[model samples]
Target chain A: MSTLGLIFRELRHHKANAALVVLALAGTVALLVAVRILATAAERETRRVTRDLGFNLRILPRDVDPDQFLADGHSDKTLPADAVTRLAAAAGTFVSFNHLTPSLERRIQLGGRDAILDGLGPSVVGPGEKKQPMGFNIPSGKAYIGHALAQRLDARPGATIDVKGKALAVERVLVESGTDDDIRLYTSLADAQSILGLPGRISEIRAIDCLCMTGEQDALAQLRNALERSLPEARVLQIRAIADARARQRQTAEKYTAFAVPLVLIVGAAWVGILAALNVRERRPEIGLWRALGNGSVRIASLVLGRAVILGVAGAAMGYFVGTQLALQAGPRIFPVTAAGIVADPSLAWWALLIAPGFAAVASFLPAMLAVAHDPAETLRAD
Target chain B: MVSCDHLVRTFAARAGTVAALDDVSFRVERGEFVAIHGASGSGKSTLLLTLGGMLRPTSGAVSIDGRDLYSLSAGARTRFRASTIGFVFQLFHLVPYLDVRQNILAGVPRPDADARARVDRLIEELGLGPRAESLPSTLSAGERQRVALARALAKQPPLILADEPTGNLDPVNAGVVFRRLADYQRAGGTVLVVTHGNDAAPYATRTLRLDHGRLAARLTTEVL
Candidate 1:
């Protein structure tokens, strides 16, 4: 028999004890992997929600009510087209700017039903304006509708539909925002104005205030100062609640991720360490017998350490598989992602697989030492 | 050939240090089956352990084939024990996890074809052919001791050291163990065994008796 075969024989002799060690190790690795994935998923979900909120700060006329903007649809405080244009110029590389001029009441008839048809002008984004989920870069004679509206009208991209006596091609369908975005249809500024017979008029100019994960603290202050200096007619609306909530959301996500990973590692190491020590204790006599049978201290140590290697690696591999399944099923359910939005973050997974066995090995170090420390003369002499 | 020159082994207790082998000495030639007889606690096991390099002597030295055993490093001494000396215990130190064949094979670090043949022959000679694949737990006292003896001879070492080899066996099984040791002596190998009584006296070419860890003078038994 081979040297490795000797270790296997010992395992078979103490099958229940070996299984206990393996199970404890597997649980440790599985929990560690799950915690890491949850942390990553939390951060990713925060970013996705922040992007879906469209714009953080909106530049509306001074008369616009802070609390009633959603109900008024920015139509209660109208701004001229040139005023919107110069405000974009004044912002100058500091923001992503878009102008909106709704259809009078901002609700129109489409496919024989009343729907929100907002006249959205093209957005002016800086060279480094990371993402523009709601930029609304509309062109003439084409339109984008929300997922609910498309479903109601059975409309798809590239199909033409009659809108107020004019044929417009369906450009794209937006994902469900779970808000009024579901009932809204955004048409080009020129098309909406001509159709409403109110050319060169806009309800409001919207500005996404920051370039970072959030735009609440210094970015919001800078925007207030910029607008006060240049476009005094428009006061930067803080959008009240979203401004504060976004910053708090991001901070909580990052902190949770940081705190959870280390905690998982500590728990996993503890489980493996205790169980490995017990496993060594259970095999003390076997170790002594091997020593008495003309095997040296080094060979005895190899037998113990070899068992640790197998348990560590085997437990880690099994944990990776089980943990991935758990993460996949739980991630989308937690984030409410309808599609397969599980970003596995392969780098993190690779680290888990690499570190799990390392936990097992390091945990077994003291136990392996204890195994070789037995007095063969006394131990073998015992019944 | 083996020689022990004034070997002294001491153990310390809370009260004082006591010598297990008090200035003891002996010499044995090749192919000599010598039995060292003593009562319990006569330090017969200590003498065998010191000679086998399993225990270190506090003073003096043991040399096998002109090489000083105590002069070598700890690692070298272990290797010397594994490659040159074979050991059998009163309790029959057979690995319970392994079958008789594997227990025999366990003595050889890496058993090649010749080593494997040596183990097979020892198993057959010990009358353990049918029980080669059986675990030691299932074997009788005689069979277990025979397996232990086979394991000791697995490497075909130049010397065999058996401490109370038949101490745990019945009279019939004790006779079985002595006959095997006698046969090994006839094959031109040195054998040194420790026993509490005359169970192995008929098989030994000479007997060295010990009392209170000291060799008794005029203690020799010549078998014609």
Candidate 2:
């Protein structure tokens, strides 16, 4: 009979032992798979929640007065519009910053009332970054008028409005945010520069900081250092509340996975090793008999290790299915914002198939060696 | 044919070193059924294992068919043992998971149709046909021993080493085991049986008495 046939028969005879090993392997794989999928969903949820908190890093012209800029929430001085491009093109700039939006914000008279005119340029992103742009992308002649400003001007969607002798189409009315945004008129950067009589100039660049570090790590210092090297003419200001919240959320999720994965792996390996040892112990007499029957060490070792690999494969398949189902069922309730993005990752299944068997084999290696090293004379001569 | 030259196998005990086979020498010609009888701890099993190439003696040498058993590499020795010798243990060490037929087939190294046919014949001769597919656990002590005997005889090796082959059987079962070994010997195979009792005396061509790892006496079957 083939060695595999023997192994199968042995596994069938020792169903409880085999089932326990498969269970341990399956549980470990399930925990790892669930952790991986859930961790990804947690990251997505963090990004969405933090992105909704708005851009935390402000890149203002270096020469702007700090007090006046802080009070006015807009820089009096301006940088050339291409400064955003220059900063984005800088090496490793996106390592600390993303979603770079150049804007010219200033208080203007609209329909005989004071309103903030916020002109947003096309967002400059990191090279090869697939993240969706954060803010609106308005056309040259279109505007997204604030709720109060739309009421004041009696403007509706697709209505034509006049701004400094230029005609602009009202694209949409913004929802009331109960902030200065309610009285803000948003337009394309080129239109703002034209109306403000400062063509090709932007007052500031808004961005979200990517340095997910705690306050104790001095995140602002790192952001400043990065900005100084990338855009020497601009200085960065961080909104502490938003930056800290995003940092804590991201770090918490990372810390959870970092602690969980290794713990599960260690416990799983120990469990497998112990069970393999027990199996070797139980089969001592049979192993001796095989040795006396002229079976070589390779054949003896294959019996033990082969069973582990088979169980590992079964565990991988079962765990992948169960874990994917768990994530699909529980992900929406946990991270409702990115629930639609939580789908089964086929690559994870392939990875499980590749890794689990090797892991089980490594764990069972010592026991297999013990079986090979057993002395046939010891048991055979016992009579 | 098997021969050993002044073989000495020692075990390290807490009291001191003790020889299991103390400079003992013997020879067995082909087609002979030899029985070595000794009391418990008289080194009967040790001598049998040493000759089987399963145990390496502390000193001296063993040759099977003129090839130095210990001088060969471990792999070569295993292959030599597989092709030249078959072993039956007192405890009937059958693989618990395999049925009687598979356990019997396990003895046939490089099993083929001829080996399978021989195994079937041995199974029938040993009266294990009804229990062919039954695992060793389901078999009685007598039946398990018969299966072990069938397994040993399956490969039809020139040498059969029976270590207390009937130690766990009743008188009737023990007679059946000796009869099978004697039949194999009559068919031109060599047999070596080590037992604490003289249960194998009737079938043995000659009997060697062992006392405290020494050859105390040698007697021809006519003396019995």
Candidate 3:
């Protein structure tokens, strides 16, 4: 018989034992894989949402008169034209700036229908900003409307909509940024400032981005200090990294695995060992005769271990099947949806299935060791 | 081809160290059929174990082919045992879960073609072909013993150690087993049998009688 054939024969001898071990290992691997996917997808979704909203740090004059804009039915909070230059000089890097005011309740005419307009814009952004989920840039007299807001205003691209008495044509529809994208609009900073009638006053300087060291606490401290020194009047904030978000979710997943994996491994080991012990006890004379017949300690040990490997392998295979079924069934709901669509990675679950059985074999080793360490002669001679 | 000098075996039980075999020594040459006749606790099995390299001698040397067994490392000794010796038990300790053929093959190092062919030939010669696919539980006491012999012979070892190889056999199967051992000897294999039965003593070239932890006599068949 081939080595595997012999092992298979031995494993088949104890059906119940093999099943238990495989189930334990499969369950552990499945749990680990699922949690990993969950954590990863959550991180991805968080970053997607954050990036879609634009501007990790939003800065404005610390005190802005809200009543001035409200009473006059229009307001502009435009900063000085040199504000971007100043921030660029202070940060030692050129920084892009966008001017925006949150949408105020007001009326707009879409076609012949009057509807409440909810749009804010006239923001300048860096190169990559336009591609973000909820970001857009337009020239004067044009606007990008949210899907929900556009539907409410009966507005489509190329259609004119009145925003606070200033008429602008819709340039595009902002699709799928969840609820936030549905309620906002996009316009050029100049147009927003002009419409709001506050040409010299900017509402808030929307700070684009500055990449920095994530792991080095001292570097982060220095960077924070630098931002403070550079934009002293504007509060500086650090945006969370995609890596940090992923790591946090992964940490939560790892915590679950740390507690659960050992339990599964120990249970798998014990199950194989207990069954093997019983098998050995039942075949005491046979084991003895093997030793007496010149089967060395290693051979006897192999015979015992071979049996456990068989069981472990069988169990791992079974568990893998069960786990994959679970992952496929549950994976979609956890990720929910992405900007593109629902996110799922089936290969990760399959990888878990393939890796679990090897672990099962390892778990069986301890039990195999205990069962093979017997005195052949004495065991054989006993009734 | 085998010798033991002043061998001692002790086991520490809950009650303390008990001497199972004390200062025992004997030898068997190639092609010799030797029977170690002893009553219970007379150390016949212990002597067999020490010779087989399964049990280490506590106080003396046991050698095969002029090489001291204890002098070899643990792994080497195991290889030595696998290559040089085969074992048969009176109780027919076949692995019951495996089919007869598989149990027979299990005696060999692994599932080599030669081992399988040897086992197949042994099965046919021993009239076990009809039962080869069956488990041990399906075989009679005599058939089980025959299967056990087939397993032992599968390795084609130079030495055959039988711990009461015919103990569970009836008179008819006992005669068959004894004749088989004689045939093995005729083929130039050494046979050392530990037994309580004196009925097979005439078939032995020499009888080493064990009584109360010592070899009482090395009697030839004529003398017996």
Q: Which candidate is the best by DockQ?
A: 2
Candidate number that wins on TM-score, 2 or 3: 2
The candidates' DockQ values read: 0.28, 0.64, 0.40
- Give the interface RMSD of each candidate: 2.7, 1.0, 2.5
**True interface contacts reproduced, per candidate:** 0.34, 0.62, 0.39
- Which digits, one per residue and each the tens of the lDDT, describe model 3 over residues A128-175? 455342345467788888777887777888999777688888889778
Best by TM-score: 2
> Which numbered prediction scores highest in lDDT against the true structure?
2
Per-residue lDDT over A182-277 for candidate 2, one digit per residue giving the tens place of the 0 to 100 score: 999999999999999999999999999988785479889989999999999999989989988999999999999999999999999999989999
Q: Name the regions of candidate 2 deviating beyond 4 angstroms.
A: A62-68, A85-96, A109-115, A126-130, A137-185, A211-241, B12-19
List per-candidate RMSD values in Å. Answer: 7.8, 3.4, 7.1
Q: Give the alpha carbon lDDT tens digit for every residue of B104-220 in model 3.
A: 887887658877888899999888999989988899999999998888788888988888888888999988888888889899999999898786797899898888778887877
**In model 1 chain A, which range of ten residues has the least summed lDDT?**
A96-105
Q: Rank the candidates by DockQ, best first.
A: 2, 3, 1
A best-first ranking of the candidates according to their lDDT comes to 2, 1, 3
lDDT of 1 at B218: 35
TM-score of 3: 0.73
lDDT of 3: 0.66
